[model samples]
Target: MIFVETQYDQTPAALNDLVENAALAALKHQSAPENATVTIVLTDDEQMHSLNLDYLGVDAPTDVLSFPSEEIDPETGDPYLGDILISVPRAANQAESTGHDVESEAQLLTVHGILHLMGHDHAEPEEKERMWQAQAEILTKLGLGNIQVRES
Candidate 1:
């Protein structure tokens, strides 16, 4: 299951669908289990700043953050992938700078976060190449081939 919670009041209604589709695309690309579940949280910069500081020791706000979990829900027996938090304001800014709409940027971030939850990382050169390639392929499948993820 894919769950989305919007803590930001200004988020558009269509954003929820975008996030869900992006997540599903990423999961399908990764060949995740059919019963896997994940949550996506759309929030503001203030909450993102606090989360970044508390969890990653980074004092600055970020566009997206993913916390991976490998737990199974006892009741449903679904694999809980984890939670993804995205700053709506940050995504808007990034979208403005990248010459795309907020919807596309949010979807990009969604895909990026799901990739992370699926154990894709860019800490090393080779890892980054692989992850980026996978991300691009997923984005293309989502009809966002022209939307490039900005370097952070």
Candidate 2:
């Protein structure tokens, strides 16, 4: 199952579909289990800053953060992938600078987060290449071929 929540009041109503579709595309590309579950949260920079500081010891706000989990829901027996939190205001700013809309930016972030949850990382040169290739392929399949992930 895929769940989406928005803590910002200015978020669009279509955000749910955007997140779900992006997540589904990533999961399908990765060949994730049929019953895999994940959650996507759209929040503010303040919350992101706090999470970054607390969890990653980074005192700055980031565009997206993924917390990977390996737990299973006893009742449903679904594998809980983890939670993805995105700072909506940051995404808006990135979109403006990247010459794309916030919706497209959010979708890109969604795919990036899902890839992280699936153990794809860009920490090393080879790992980054593989992850970026997979991300590009997934984005292309989602009709977002032009949207590129900015290097941080």
Candidate 3:
């Protein structure tokens, strides 16, 4: 299951169908066990800037942040993947810069965050290759409303 909480003025603050589709795509792409859950939060740059500084030691606003909770929920036994927080304004700018729609950019971030939750990292060359391959595959499966994965 995917739950999204947004605190921004972006109309249609959240897109339920795309979120569900991409999340399910992530789970299926990873062969994740059943009963997995993830939460996505959409806020502004200030919130993300503070979070980035506090956790990553980077005093800058990033497009997205993924916090993976690799433990099972006590009561439900659900594999809680993590939280994906996005800066809506940042995403909008990124989308415009990248020649894509805001929704597409946000979904890409969702795919990236879901990949992180599934233990895919891009800190090293080999890891990056695998992560990009996985992202491409997931996004391809997602077909993301015609937005393709950008080379990273």
Candidate 4:
């Protein structure tokens, strides 16, 4: 199951569908177990700033943050994939700058976060290429083929 909680009303109605589709795509791409779940939190820049500072020690708000959990929940036995936090404000700005709607930007972030949960990282050159390729393919399948993956 995929859980979506929005602290901001600006989130698009398609948020839940996009998240669930992206999660399924990620799991399929990674050959991960299907008994998995993820939580997506849509929030404003203030909350994002606090979370970024608290977790990553970065004082500024970020587009997305992924907290990957260890596989297999002891209680439910599900492959708990952990949480994904998206800053709606940041995504809006990026969408405007990129000439896309906020929903597409949010979808892109969701895919990126899912890749992270699957252990994809862009910290290294080769890793960035692989991760971006996987993200592009997934986004294309999600009908967001033109969405640009922002470099961090």
Candidate 5:
């Protein structure tokens, strides 16, 4: 099981659990190395905006950002994926915009974040297709059909 830490005070209890479940499910579906570890830090949009500007050269806050630490470990066979940081307030706004519950939207973003940790990206057409399909399957299996994953 993966451990998730949140810096936001308003983050709901169920939100963390949903994120964990999504991470576990994504790891299993991706066939990642056993016991692969990563950390997730949830914060408000203001913090996320600063992080985005500092790390990604963007001025706006994003839903999630993934920083891959050890894609391939030489010492250990287990591949340490990466760290995922999500904005709780942004997620809440997205949930409202996408017509889904807060928990479901957060879980979707969590799944998307875990996919990035596994080296899945959506910058190109083929890559986006594969990543989105994987996310859709994982979300569907996790009972997230009502929540849509738009190709943005």
Candidate 6:
């Protein structure tokens, strides 16, 4: 199951569909278990900054943050991949500069976060290439082939 929560007051309802489709596409591309679950939370820069500072020791807000989990949910016995938190405001800002809609930016962030939960990291040159390729493939499959996540 894919779950999405929007904490921002101005977040559009359509954002949920974009997030859900992106999450599902990434999971399908990875051949994740049918019982696997992924949760997405959309918020503002303030919440993202707080989470980044508290968990990652960073003082700035990022586009997305993933908390991976390999264990099954005790009550449901379903494999819970993890939680993906996105800053809607951040996504909007990125979309503005990237010449894409916020929905597409949200989808890109969703794919990026799901890749992280699936153990893909871009800390090195080769790893970045591999991860970016995977992102391209997944986005293409989702019909957003032209969308690219800007390097930071």
Top candidate when judged by lDDT against the true structure:
1
lDDT of 4 by residue, 63-103 (tens): 99999998787898998988999998898899899999888
lDDT, model 4, position 35: 81
Q: How accurate is candidate 5 locally (lDDT)?
A: 0.86
Per-prediction RMSD in angstroms? 0.7, 0.8, 2.0, 1.3, 2.0, 1.0
The ten-residue window of minimal lDDT in model 3 covers 11-20
Report residue 115 deviation for candidate 5 (angstroms): 0.9
10 residues in a row with least lDDT, candidate 1: 143-152
TM-score of 2: 0.98
Better of 2 and 4 by lDDT: 2
Which digits, one per residue and each the tens of the lDDT, describe model 6 over residues 56-150? 99999998999999988899899999999999999999999989899999999999999999999989999889889889999999899999755
> What is the descending TM-score order?
1, 2, 6, 4, 5, 3
The residue ranges of model 3 lying beyond 4 angstroms of the native Cα positions read 11-14, 145-152
- Score candidate 6 by TM-score against the native: 0.96
- Spell out the clash pairs found in candidate 6: none
Residue-by-residue lDDT tens digits, candidate 1, 35-91: 999999999999999999999999999999999999999999899999999999999
Q: Using lDDT as the measure, what is the rank order of every candidate, best first? A: 1, 2, 6, 4, 5, 3
- Candidate 5's C-alpha runs over 4 A off are 71-78
Kindly indicate the candidate among 3 and 6 with the higher TM-score.
Answer: 6
TM-score of each: 0.98, 0.98, 0.90, 0.93, 0.92, 0.96
Candidate 2 worst ten-residue window by lDDT = 143-152
Superior candidate under lDDT, 1 versus 3:
1
lDDT of 3 by residue, 16-102 (tens): 466667777888889988788888887899999999999999989998899989888999888888898888888789889878888
